[model samples]
Target: MSIWGRVFAAGYDRIMEGAEKSVLRAHRQALVGRASGRVLEIGGGTGANLPFYGDDVAELVITEPEEPMARRLEDKLAASARTAEVVRAPAEDLPFVDASFDVVVSTLVLCTVGDPAKSLTEIRRLLKPDGRLLFLEHVRSDDPGLARWQDRLHGIQVRIGHGCHCNRDTLASIESAGFTVSELRHDQLLKAPPIVRPLVIGIAQAKA
Candidate 1:
């Protein structure tokens, strides 16, 4: 991993502190708390969702592609005394068998996947027929002018965020990935810049 990866991992929770206190913590508590059965969380950065997971979850597995982030995630899990497992794995090429999970959680993750379509496909593959996907992602702006701004500033955002695209149509991507969106809500990512503020929190399941 590059030096920036370590730096990013080191400062991950600190940088997100403001947003976490003001907005993200509540969102996570609501969404992640609902996860149950065998669960998988993709790109589990710094293990932020660790505290939110409930005892209802039969098993919890987290995957982080970046080495530095993976190490930090493990450390956090250790500190929290959570018995979850952490693996060094990317979203697109997860090293798991088919239908291995009853729920898959993605929080601020889809946009950073090297291939959103492939990653979502992998998530679909890992989930059982009745499984659900829980997602909380910042997506392309619904407003036109702000979207243009996002397009213009996207490259810089990628460099700063280390591969996260600020203008992805993640909601549409979920639908196209063969998941039926069962519940959804649009909200703003408060305490963050407007370019990446549009958020979508929802639950989806595989199409029958």
Candidate 2:
């Protein structure tokens, strides 16, 4: 990982604590009934989903590539009501058997993955044949001007805020990775001028 990524991981949980507690909570709440069985959370930063998981979920396994972020995730898991296993690994190379999980949850992680399609493929592999993949991501805007601005600012943002890119087409990547949309929605998460990102939520099932 880049030094900047490590730095960002160290303080990211603290920096985004409020947003996780506030802005992100409602969106996550909508997913309560969807998560169940053995759940695998890719890029499970600071175990944010631990608190939101449903009681029916038998196990929760989280993968986080960044060591510093993994530490935070461990700490949060310890404090959370949800019981979970934490793994320090990237989404592309998950250390588990195929079809190991019944539900795969990813929130705001695609933008940072070096290859979103590959990561999504890994998610598909981990999911059971009838399993669901639930996601919450920020995608590129449709406005030409905004898209251009995202392209312009992405490089700087990646340098400063870890590997977070502002313009990933997360929906397209998921589709290409062999998942079909079951439920989908798009909305704004922030009200800042120019609106750098639009939040996207979807429930997808394995192709089989």
Candidate 3:
């Protein structure tokens, strides 16, 4: 990880606290509350979603690539009522068998991955035939004017945000990866910057 990556990881929880209280807390609770059977959460930064997982989840595995973030996630997992195995791994290269999980989750992570297509393909590979993928991601805005601004500032955003692209077309990437989107909702975050505020929260199933 780069120095900025380390700095961001160290302050991630503190930075996200306000957004968590305003909207993300509820969004995460609703998204993870429905997950069941074997679960795998990609990019489990600081274990923010750990508290929302339902009791019905048979097993939970969280993957975090950054050492600093993974260590913080471990601390969060240790205190949670729910038990999960925390592994240090990247989203594009998950170390799991095909069709190993019944449900997979991605929240606030698709934007930062080096290759969204590869990561989504991996998510599809890890899911069972009838498995579901629940995601809450910030995506490129549809508004032309705002999109222009996103395009303008994207480079700087990536440099400062630890590889997080502010204008990724995450929903389209999920579709291109062969996951049939079942439900999707678009909205802006309450306390986030406009460039990264446009969000897509939804569920998708791996194509059989």
Candidate 4:
């Protein structure tokens, strides 16, 4: 990461902390019954999901690349009742064996991966044949005008947000990786200021 990249990530995380926590808190209850067994969460920044997870999960492993963010997650984990493990790594190239996890989760992470397709492929590989991949992501708008604006601002956004893109069609990417969708829901996260895009969330099962 560049010097400016680090600065941008720091500022971005700090600014979005409250909104993210709020959003996660609301959506997390839905995640409780799904995440189970050996779960691997990609881009689990600051261990925000710790509070939401239930006792059903046997183990929780987080892969977070940002060093500063990982430290913050350590602090969060210190207070968490769940026994969690943190890996300072990126989603694109995960360091784990094939079919290693029973559940894989990614929240607002696909938009920033170096290669979203490749990362999803890796996630698929890491998951057991019958494992599930659950995700919450912001995606490209269907509106022509809004999409154009997203395309235009995406360049600048990626620079300041450590490659985070607001226009990725993450659902399509997951489907392209050969996963079978089990359930899905979409909602608008920002209804006032940036009211154009919607949050795309889904739970998919790896084909057996």
Candidate 5:
């Protein structure tokens, strides 16, 4: 987990540069651009999605629990020339009131939370009745062979990723948490190892 410390924070952007250029950056643009009104983002790692937020957004707040990541995020926020707030908070324990936000953004973040289901429940609680959750995550593969690989490599990936699980059934978890996945795009995390490549991007809203 020390790797997820200062060293990871210092080199995080550089490490993901290739993946960002290959596929992630575009996906971020498409999903994050849709964010509007009062928005709250979980993790906000390195502020990678910082550049894509559209001007229609009424207010933007990002929470990051890790000190190392939060420091990096704050630094990036200082340089981004954008108007937003950065808070030191975890996904599973956000401080906002219920139904306070119109959008909750989670990009490449759900898999790494301390409690994915609980974190999402908090997201649901924070969102307004019609609010949206914009998410892009790598989940357990549908293929049995690949899923097996994901299972084998999951621990190693978590160690290296600092808490990221390579084999979570994230989409299913979202549905179980009571959100209706309104739009979905199945995709691959290009330029990554097979065990962690399976991906899904989508929008979900709380059920009535």
Candidate 6:
């Protein structure tokens, strides 16, 4: 990680403390609680989702590209009940065999990946034939006014928020990557900024 990257990651937990307490903690638990079998989690930021995986999960592997963030995640995982191997790698290029993981997880990460499409493709490649993807992401809103604002502020958000884009049509990106969305729910974060509050939570399966 660069100096700026380290700087952003150093304060990441403190910055998100409020959101975690108010809304994200519960949401992450609910989403990660359902994972089963051999699992892979993309962008395990500060290991916030680490405490939520249930015993049904046989093995857990977490990937984080940024060194500073990965280091923090390792620290959190050290104290977690559920053990997980931390891999320093980008989502766009996973170092695993094809059809290896039963479940792939991405929470609040797609928006920040350098290439969401490539990342999803790699995720699909790593999944078993019957594997499913579990995700909780903030996406472009249906409301035109809010979406416009998201678009206008997206560049600035990326610059400051570690490459997060507030206006991506994530559902469309998922579909384009050939994942058949099986279950989807929409909601807003309890106390998040409007640009990033529109949330999409769901399960998606690799297209047969």
Question: What is candidate 3's CA lDDT for residue 182?
Answer: 99
Please say which candidate is ahead in lDDT: 2 or 3.
3
The candidate scoring highest on TM-score is 1
Clashing pairs in 3: none
Clashing pairs in 5: none
TM-score of 1: 0.98
Poorest 10 consecutive residues by lDDT, candidate 6: 185-194
Model 1: residues with Cα > 4 Å off, grouped in runs:
none
Misplaced by over 4 Å in model 3 are none
Q: Pick the lDDT winner.
A: 1
What tens digits encode model 5's per-residue C-alpha lDDT throughout 85-150?
999899999999999999999998999998999999999999999999999999999999999988
* Ten residues in sequence with the least summed lDDT for candidate 4: 189-198
Q: Identify the superior model by TM-score, candidate 1 or candidate 6.
A: 1
> Comparing candidate 2 with candidate 6, which one achieves the higher TM-score?
6
> Residue 184 CA error for candidate 3 (Å)?
1.0
* Alpha-carbon deviation at 143 in model 4, angstroms: 1.5
RMSD to native for every prediction?
Answer: 0.7, 1.9, 0.8, 2.1, 1.1, 1.0
lDDT of each: 0.94, 0.82, 0.93, 0.81, 0.92, 0.92
- Looking at candidate 4, what is the lDDT of residue 13? 55
Superposed model 6: Cα runs more than 4 Å off: none
Write candidate 4's Cα lDDT for 1-208 as tens digits: 5787567545755667666665645776686457889999999876667787777799999999988778878888898777888999999899999999999989878988899989999999999988999888788888888888888888887766677888887888899998988988887764222522478778998776
lDDT of 6 by residue, 18-80 (tens): 878988888888889999999999999889898889999999999999999999999888876
Provide the TM-score for each candidate, comma-separated. Answer: 0.98, 0.92, 0.98, 0.91, 0.97, 0.97
Q: Return the clash pairs for model 2, or none.
A: none
Model 4: lDDT of residue 36? 88
Once fitted onto the true fold, the runs of candidate 4 whose alpha carbons sit more than 4 angstroms away are: 8-13, 191-196
